[model samples]
Target: MAGALLSTPNRVSLERLVQVAKERGYTAQGEMFSVADMAKLAQETLGCQAELLCGGLGGPNRDGVLQHLITGHPLLIPYDEDFNHEPCQKKGHKAHWAVSAGVLIGVQNVPSPGYIEDSELPGLFHPVPGAPHQPPSFPEESSPGAIFLLSKQGKSWHYQLWDYSQVRDSNLQLTDFSPARAADGRVYVVPAGGVKAGLCGQALLLSPQEGSHQLGLGHLPQLNPAH
Candidate 1:
């Protein structure tokens, strides 16, 4: 006789499938299908209790809504493939804060007309939001955490960002002046985590010292554990 269950999956059966996945790993490609399928897969595979998988490829195209990945457990899903806020020039329907944050950091060194930049950054970083006229020029970032503030770029939120490592030394306390660094350079500080779906865990950032612009958790193995 076959070992696997043969009957249709009930709520209990389905949850068990998900639980087994959690103990082993959470990178299953899901039931292998469409948006609804992806959503269901997120719910089961990522253990999101109730998955959304919103925005971009597997989500709705609505503005001002929080495009979450799942509802229960956390999963940091990247809404955009390129992760460009505003998508393209003359086409940004609304501001995507995640993109905007990276844009600010990316264009930190561009020579453009705008608010005066801090002497330390010269023209690298800014505090205000950009308009269609003064669109941001995001060259790149080597990590994803720098854009955490803007991750909630949708109307659902407006998160305050911090570079705690920029402010504190190894002690994790505010110092008069501390410039200690992490391997990834700057890490965005939040109210102790749990920002939103697709951005709950720390979204790693680019290293100020390194000349890289890669972010997003590197691809997880596709069931092939022996990498």
Candidate 2:
């Protein structure tokens, strides 16, 4: 009943998800809810495409705030840590995500946080060769928000961060959950089962100051139970 009430036809709207994200302090954002190649593959292999939402989140302390929304998936946020003892001065890093054997790994793209545009990440990560793996100083200064990662695995989900040297574990219990108020005095909800979005799916960038890029829903033929 909780999931049913939260999702219509078993799907959550991107608009609703954005509303919740804004309440949590992430204002500038982007989403990748579907991919042309992935949709094609799903149609050819299973006759039904996978419908999910993935994207980026940028704001003050957005890196830490994003951890609350990550569950068994990945989100791209501005890399907020010092690299090998140097403080990053811009949005030059990204947190990439993938799941192997049910473990969600958030790979930190060091040296240079990747760029964020109207679409998804470039999908090509070239970390510095022989990058040093040293302890990152916590409570680092805030950087402009970047991207986010989301995914699903069987019945269980998780949101964990991993780099070449360490993995930081995090989780959000969103099932049958009630609305929660963040520091902004706004109440928001994380849908039951975490919104049925995907890690590497279709996405749009969210900017509190600008409009989003849109594709006619008519063109998205693979949207099952689309919102």
Q: Tell me each candidate's TM-score.
A: 0.20, 0.18
- Summing lDDT over every window of 10 consecutive residues in candidate 1, give the lowest-scoring window: 63-72
Residue lDDT tens for model 2, 1-227: 11221122334444654554455433334321123323333223222323332232222222432322221112222121333321122221222222221122233543233222224555433322234323222223232122323332222244332331121112111112212222445443322333223211222111111121311111122222224
Whole-model Cα lDDT per candidate?
0.26, 0.26
TM-score of 2: 0.18
